[model samples]
Target: KSQEFLPPDEALEDPAQIAPGDWTLEQRRPWTGYAPPYAPDLNALETQVARFRRGDSLLVVGAFEPQEEEQPETDTRRQSMNPRIVDVRSRRNESRGERQARSNPFGRIQEEPVPFLPEEPEKTAPVQSGLFLIDTETGTHHEVLGEGPRGAFQLLVPNGRYIIGVEAFSPDDKRAWRDRHGLWQDPLVLGLAAVSDLLILKGGGNLPESLDEALPTAMPVTRIRTGESFKAAWELYGLRIGESASVRIGVDRGGEGFIRRLGQFLRVLEPDAPVVMTYEDTGPDVLGTVFRAVELNLPDLEPGEYTLTVEIELSGREPMVIARPIVIVP
Candidate 1:
């Protein structure tokens, strides 16, 4: 019998069809493209036998030289390539108006033209001439009137600290005149016994029996908690005879340079958290001893010191201003 030897390529096994423990490479077939499929059972058994030969348990394979876990690498440099996310955090702190101005493709927001209301003819006063005689000693007043062109008038009364006021009425029958502040208009004060001085009245004028001697008093709490309701009591002297009185209460962050108007600040910082105010009469009579109280609904404000400003608007005079310092704590 003749013995025949096969070539190395013919004797080599295909890696795809070989089992892990069954496949081996010889020196003659060192370059063979032969790799066996992975087998966990075969590897575990072989590891057990090796450990037993070394007088160790099979579980020691994981303890002595544990297989390292393969972790996929993440490329953070590639993730930071997006443009919008590059400086996203910094842009968040910008104000809404600033953001709107910056985001606008055109320079500014477009505004629409406002329509004008037609002007009506001015009404002249029906009662052209009126005389007011006030007795300073008794705080009493008497009035004399004539409906005609303004003319010189004379009144002979007991001479003792007396004041006389002349007034012209508007042709419009409106009972009340509003001041510049949209509140009840106060009468013009004319000094006593002056012949040369002329008194010019814009609207209906009255000779008050007694001047309003009461000054306004405001008592505001110094500190308030967030989301709490507080009362600001104001004592006003002499009459609540007006359509309505308005009180405006505003808050500002302390030490923020110049303080801004409440509406302006609310339009920027807390658009939804508006400056709230409520008005009520605490007076005994409609035309005497006016006592007013206002309520303020505080929002969730940051813990800090703040300045509170109160503006009281009565029959059309300049609004009275009151300011108080307050604190909000956690």
Candidate 2:
């Protein structure tokens, strides 16, 4: 029972041993020491069980980009029996470790000095860019974040049901998706946000194109200096000519104010003196969008967080309200 470390080329449990755990100490050499697993090759597969580390709520995904200049030829070729049925192991992956350097005649060279790691990831064509988590149920795209310079991207997301897919690509391939001005080169995204159910952008993403008329501009107003007046334009659909409605637009506490107001509508809560603007469909007889823009010139107030609340009440239908958070600074 006074056995110690055994040398290589000898099994710990020899077939001819007289008894279990009864190896003679003379059989083991004095200088032999423990030997760890040879050149550890760690492999991993993303599974549903592995992804949800945050108590069943998958918060985010951390993705890795491949080496840009990987030469698949240099990798030691591997041969295995081809199974009739293909599975996870048969899928192709060109990603690899550092490039092979010249046999260092002067002993083992440090990995830092040689041109080992590739400049960018995914050598072939740049793979894909941008990280998005689409909700599996509703298909709502959440936390669309761009990659950083060093080929890593991240997004902190709220708890939700999602099918996680995270990947990245090389740097030279940036021009294909982005135009010369570095803007996303997709013309279909031009549709107004309201018309597209927040798909494209409401107007165009700037100031309302028409100031006085019923026109919503792409101009988005999120922050404004105190003592300055900001205006917004909105569009409403399905209205007959001469149909009248009331609109109330004002500032309230920011953040959760939208949810609070929304709940109020469910429970039928109405304030006594809301800043209401009367809107009457004066367009043609056909049902079309009624566009209108508003300018606010309120007296000075303390600078802080607020939500621009817009409530529209039709003749008989339930009121429709939308609130956007804004910040005021001195």
Measured over all alpha carbons after superposition, the RMSD of each candidate to the real structure, in angstroms, is 42.8, 21.9
Cα lDDT of model 1 overall? 0.32
* Candidate-wise lDDT, in order: 0.32, 0.35
In candidate 1, stretches whose alpha carbon ends up further than 4 angstroms from where it belongs are 1-221, 255-274, 278-284
Report the number of clashing residue pairs per model.
12, 12
Residue range 266-306, candidate 2, lDDT tens digits: 42223642353445434436554455555664455468876
Candidate 2: stretches off by over 4 Å: 1-135, 138-221, 257-284
Model 1 poorest 10 in a row by lDDT: 46-55
The sequence of per-residue lDDT tens digits that candidate 1 reaches over residues 1-330 is 001111223124321112212221222222222111111011111100000011110100000101122333434454445342233225677774565346322223322311111123335444223444455457565544444322323333333333333333323331111000000112222321001100111111232221111111111114466765555433344333453555666666762122334431222223332365535423243543333434455676787877565555555554455544456666
